[model samples]
Target: MMENIIRLNFTKGKKTILQGQLNWSNRSADSIVGISGISGSGKTSLLRVLAGLEPEVKHHFRFNNICYSDYQAADKNIGVVFQHAHLFPHINVIENLKLALKAAHHKAKRGQANQVTSHKFELEQVIDGLAISDLLDKSVEQLSGGQKQRVAIARALLCQPCLLFLDEALSAIDKENRLEILTWLKTVNREHQLPMFFISHDSFDLQALADEIISVNDGKLISIQPIELSALSMGGGLNRAILNVQFDHHIQEHHINAYRLIEADSLKPNNGVLIYAKGVKAQSAITRILVACDQVAISTEANFNSSMINHIECKIVSILPLDETNQSVEMSIKGSASQMLYAQLSNYSIQRLDLAIGSRVWALFKLSASIAI
Candidate 1:
């Protein structure tokens, strides 16, 4: 059976700053939808509206075929983490996590023994996954910026939210720790199947993490494009060009000795192609192929029922949450050929198939799904 997922269509903001209808849908169970724009472009405002942190003048938000009012959204099991780790200075890390858990429990129906045990297990899992079991005994004020941010994330996860929103959650940490935390967050999302919506000004982060990017201008959604890695032609030459391509995280510099150029039928940017390349190896030649993450699917077994042509047994290298609101999964898959491919699937699928790091899976994609760069 197909799930209705989430469908949102609405407008917000009275002034010209943010006054346009935004239509979005999450067909999958998990997604990471990214919103990017210049500062003051109302990126944060849109997130606040969706998360019920800010009021919307006009809005329609629906999830799983159920329409939710603003009040309902406000009470929804949604977790949010901001740029700063706003932990209670007077409290210790464990206390903060316990407080969040208690609050979540308090609002729910009377907990049974099994439910309580389940919650306790989940809490322990989150604490350990975030690697904050040791830090739990430390005071919030005594922790470093990175430690505090991890605790904040752990607190949010302890609530067992249906949706998680991160508004520059890693910005407070130093560059090295920020990246480490990001990797940990990916692992958490994969194992927990928690959907997330992340806001960032860093193009690299968005490109590396997001499945679908939402570009906003003046509070209006200007473009929604899949994040595809492209091999750009670097050197200039009349007959040949040097193409810098990245595959399996390794840069393979290709000199296009001879190739035919085929312009795309449609007038879309980044829609042209090199018909053929002679000098590059056959396996590495497809490095110029731009594969949309969403077009590729992952499964525990080979999809014999489907007609998708490109099927490769792959190892799950990493799984990152693309958009939590949609419950999307962005995974880095390494084929036996040492080629790296990105596949996007739902959190439901990940959970159903029991996919995890180092798990062997089949990456399925159609030949037509790949576009020449």
Candidate 2:
């Protein structure tokens, strides 16, 4: 079980939207937790309460394993982003980012003064990673819907908070922009290890990003489900098969050991593939990765002595970052059409290379270093 950053045990308002049964325990501190529920289900209200943005509501809240409130006030680090862009139309992009950092800085403890300065450095790095360096002076009114959202994301991250709340922040964007933002969000969550609370109504949106799907209706939380594959098997076999993957952890090589017998008719087809391996572990040679546009770092000059084993020369297509905290530098490699790889790097690196959206570089990684399947 995971320890949650916060929990709720009290009711809100006259409607009795949340009856006494809602509870989430064992939540990791730096997790990208998402909430999916229908409209008028109080998702926004829940976010407000957790963030301490709304104090009138009755509830119990905790921060970093310490109880904050059972209707009592407790100071906690929190950053929030609403559906709208919330950018000041008169302010420029970088100026907006600085404002967000200043606000978060005020929340820092008196003894932790150095943390505020360090956080400022991080904010600059985050802004650079966002790839809006050239647009720093561009006013908010000059930005498009997508661009505004990107700035908003950077502002949220610049806060350097322990917990973040996103209340359908992507709802106003177009489809292409929405997809692009989702990829960036995934990258940020993995790279920075920031825990978040994402509220949305779309199932497809949740499927592409959520570690656990929690459904809410009329203010009540339904059961949460995690996606998993049960087994892998072949067609027309009377007995079901279980793939036993064996690998050398030290050498980083993998092989199939054998298969176990089980009942047939348990398999189902999905999108063209029929078999699923849920809990089975593969040999060390194979790697499983949750893709992040930021993690795929590329360099124009390839080096032989570096630890990177997976190196591929690619043409730069587009480099995007939701905000300064998590940047996505996209590249188009040869022979792999429409396929791209990302390298997660700090804002400093993004500026050090003076990388443009279309510059050529070599994407590098250690094949053995990624998460093993």
Candidate 3:
């Protein structure tokens, strides 16, 4: 038997703001695909087209060998969470979700749609998954930016759509809440076998959720590849890596986490890495963290007494100049056991350390308030 897949072919204005060809396939029914590009480079245009929101382009959406001819035809199977939560302002949170549930039920009865790996969602489960159980009676106007997003996501779940499209859907939320919600979404994808198309300016968000990422550049599809930090092509963006970490506890309610990098290798010091973040919960199921290249510092010897908690022994793999005329350089440093992390330094610093390929050194990292995700 063949594996399941979703294929999309779309193009707009022979010389316009958007052109795209995206294909999603995997052995597992659940997969998250990412759309990324620089602003004005057609990222949103491509995403809107792929989601069938751009009706001017002829319909070209397929799932499991079944095709939907138009946006209306596709609406039944697709649920979109926009950048802003578009809930009915007059209704309270529960009312909004109930409305979605009722609409989905009506659609189910009328269309009698194919099962097609669809997941049935309960109101309780939706609210619980999004942690909106407490906000049921609150009106939409009373909710904060993050709370509104959670409600919006919960409403989408109630529709029981086979596919989900997230358009920078969680941008308004704080880092801690965002991570919590992302963790919950990962569970949703795995347990319900639901697929998602994710779009965000933040590469960390893409790495956190996407399985495959499609890069759009200057109004055309540039490339498609498996999701990784290196696959980020937003042009002149920071280099980053995502790591699984264990959260020991919050220190002094200062919103700092006693975090330890999990599976980082024997090179990582036993002391591990701690992060200074706001709104972090001890119970936060945060499994992945984004470490920026700028956050890492190179040292000839591990500094145990420094305020920076994370220190790892790594060998310099490669050093390249950002610009021949500029003194700044970037280094690819590898852990003793696996994978490379980056550090940015000046020419003077490189000369002082006399670092080179295969030269063992330490990479010090500090997680700031906004980097927990």
Instruction: State each model's CA lDDT, in order.
Output: 0.56, 0.54, 0.68
Give the Cα-based TM-score of candidate 1 against the true structure.
0.55
Write the residue-wise lDDT of candidate 1 on 1-373 in tens digits.
Answer: 2232222334434455554544456534455666677878777776666676655445555543434333444366677887788998888999999988886775465432112111222677777767789988898888988788888888877766766788877766776666556655654554555667788776545544554566677657565554432211101111111122322221137333322221122212222222222233233321234344566777788776876655656677767665662233333333122225666677778788888888888767653211222
What RMSD does model 2 have?
Answer: 17.8
Query: Order of candidates by lDDT, top first?
Result: 3, 1, 2
Q: Please identify which of the two predictions, 2 or 3, would achieve the higher lDDT against the true structure.
A: 3
- Model 2, position 319: C-alpha lDDT score: 57
Model 2 shows how many backbone clashes?
18
| Candidate 3 residue lDDT tens string, 1-373 | 2233333344544556665555655534576878787777776665566566766666466654545433354454677888899899988999999998887876677654533435788998888888888999998999998899888898987888888888889999987788778777876887787888788887777877776777877777776676653433435766666665556667775657766555544424334334344435545453556677777887888787776766766777677775543232233334223445677677777888897777778778777644554
The TM-score-based order of candidates, best leading, equals 3, 1, 2
Model 3 scores what on Cα lDDT?
Answer: 0.68
Poorest lDDT segment (10 consecutive residues) of candidate 1:
231-240
- Which residue ranges in model 3 land beyond 4 Å of their true spot? 1-17, 23-28, 62-76, 110-114, 117-119, 142-145, 229-236, 244-286, 302-307, 323-338, 366-373
- Candidate 2 lowest-lDDT run of ten: 230-239
Question: Which TM-score value belongs to model 3?
Answer: 0.76
How many clashes show up in model 1? 11
Backbone clashes, each candidate: 11, 18, 0
TM-scores of all candidate predictions against the true structure:
0.55, 0.55, 0.76
For model 2, the stretches where C-alpha displacement exceeds 4 angstroms are: 5-13, 17-21, 25-29, 63-74, 111-121, 227-373
